[model samples]
Target: MRFIIIGAGRVGLRTARVLRQEGHEVTLVERDAEKADRARGLTFEVVDGDGSRESVLQDAGVADADAVGALTGDLNANFAACLIAKHHGCRTVMRIDEDYREEIYQQYADEVDEIVYPERLGAIGAKNALLGGSIQAIADVAQSLQIVLITITDGSPMKGYTLSEVALPSDSRILAFGKANDPLGIPLPDDSLEAGDRVAVLAEFSELTEVRQLLVGDESAAAAVAGGE
Candidate 1:
């Protein structure tokens, strides 16, 4: 897919790099001459103008873009770029620094296809690194729910059990499971739960402790693993 990114800052540059790595085309719009030149130095096709302006967007080929991301630090500019992208019939994605504004922006979310809080994502990553658990939080889905990746430990009671036999907590559900190094797949009722396998689960915060205890064994086991890290 073709994407137009409205910024040449860290997030915009990284996003373009990953999309390009996934075989997508990207054009970046940056008003800062130095930032635009830096992006160009990295071989990125950059439009040297303000992304919030229609004329600048037109120069970046917004009409031909499949999607446009307003990823600048400036929320007003991001919103403006998204509105123009929407007008051009392109999928719009807006980035915001503050998660506190999610509710306010969500009210007008129809203007953009997606709204993301990079700070919240960074918090999740940091939490995962600091929290020593068999279950590492991948995302906070809602106020009380989390998306987690649970690793079935070598000595876990979950080993040799099937999905249904595991009798997961009421507030938790297994999304997928497979070998630790393998991509997750649908958890068949009869599929064996092997040690070192990993499962992605959606779980309530309150139920995570029990969920970890069941799959990872005891607190001692969790502590030992943390100690080794």
Candidate 2:
């Protein structure tokens, strides 16, 4: 696939390199001379101009692009570039920094293949590191919801329970289940949870404590459940 990345800064450059490593072609568009030159130094094809401008995008071969990612820090420029890419029949991904505007941009997400908040994702990583558990956040579904992956351990409440028998919080749901070192799949009612098995679940913030208690009976999980009493 041919991808056109708007901006040649850290994220753009890294994304391009990874795509190229995955056997995809990548072209970068940068308004800054230094950044453009730097991208070129890395042996990437770069269009030296403002990516939001039609002419500049045309110079970058946007018409032939399979996908276009607007990863610059400027939201307006990213949106403009994504709009042009959409018009050219290319899949578009626009990056935004602020979490407050996630809902506002979600309206445009269907139009632009995706609207990503890189900073928010970084913070989620830090948060997962801070809260040590068998359950770690994979992604934030919304301001009040998260998608988490949990590995069942020995003595875990979930172990030995079938999908139908296990009870998660009201606002939480298991999406998939898998054995240790295996890929996750849709859980079946007859499937039994076991030690070393993993489950991915979507959970509301308020129900996180309950979800943890159901999966792993840790001290913190017990404390949280007790505190709620």
Candidate 3:
């Protein structure tokens, strides 16, 4: 696959390198002379000009690109680049900063093939490290909902139960299940929950504690359940 990346800054350059490493051809477009020269120094094909301009993108071979990644910090520029790329029949990926509102996301989401939040992804990695080993946050489904993976431990209340026997809170639902050392897949009714097994659940923020108590019982889980009484 061939990819055209806008901006030679941190995110754009890193993405270009990864794609090149994976045997994909990558080209970079940068408005800044210094950034363009820096990319050229690393032996990458770079077009020198504004990525949002149709002529500049044409100079970067946008017509031949399989995909376009607009990863600059400027949201308007990113969106413009995506729009121009989309016009050329290329798949477009637009980068959005953390400062954007939900409405802003919704507005641009419909116009691009994909929207990427680099800062949010980094924060999710840090959050997972702080959340400990038994539980891992997969994604934020919405402002009030999250998808989490719970590893059943020996102390888990549902450790020896079957999938059909497990009951979650009203706002939560089991999404996938996997046995020890296996990959997660669609949940099966008769699949037994054993220590080391994993279950992925989507739950509202308010119901997370209840889901944790039922699926990942620990000392804190017990305390949370007791405190609610």
Q: lDDT per prediction? A: 0.84, 0.83, 0.86
Instruction: Write candidate 1's Cα lDDT for 43-69 as tens digits.
Output: 999999989999999999998999999
TM-score for all predictions? 0.88, 0.87, 0.85
Residue 196 lDDT in candidate 3: 95
Ranking, TM-score, top scorer first: 1, 2, 3
Per-residue lDDT for 52-128 in model 3, tens only?
A: 99999999999999999999999899989998999999999988886355457667466588788887767667766
Best by lDDT: 3
TM-score of 2: 0.87
- Give the range of the ten consecutive residues with the poorest summed lDDT in model 2: 220-229
The candidate, 1 or 2, that scores higher on TM-score is 1
RMSD to the hidden true structure, all candidates:
3.8, 3.6, 4.0
Instruction: Give residue 207's error in model 2 in angstroms.
Output: 1.6
* Residue 95's lDDT in candidate 3: 88
Model 2 accuracy (lDDT, Cα): 0.83
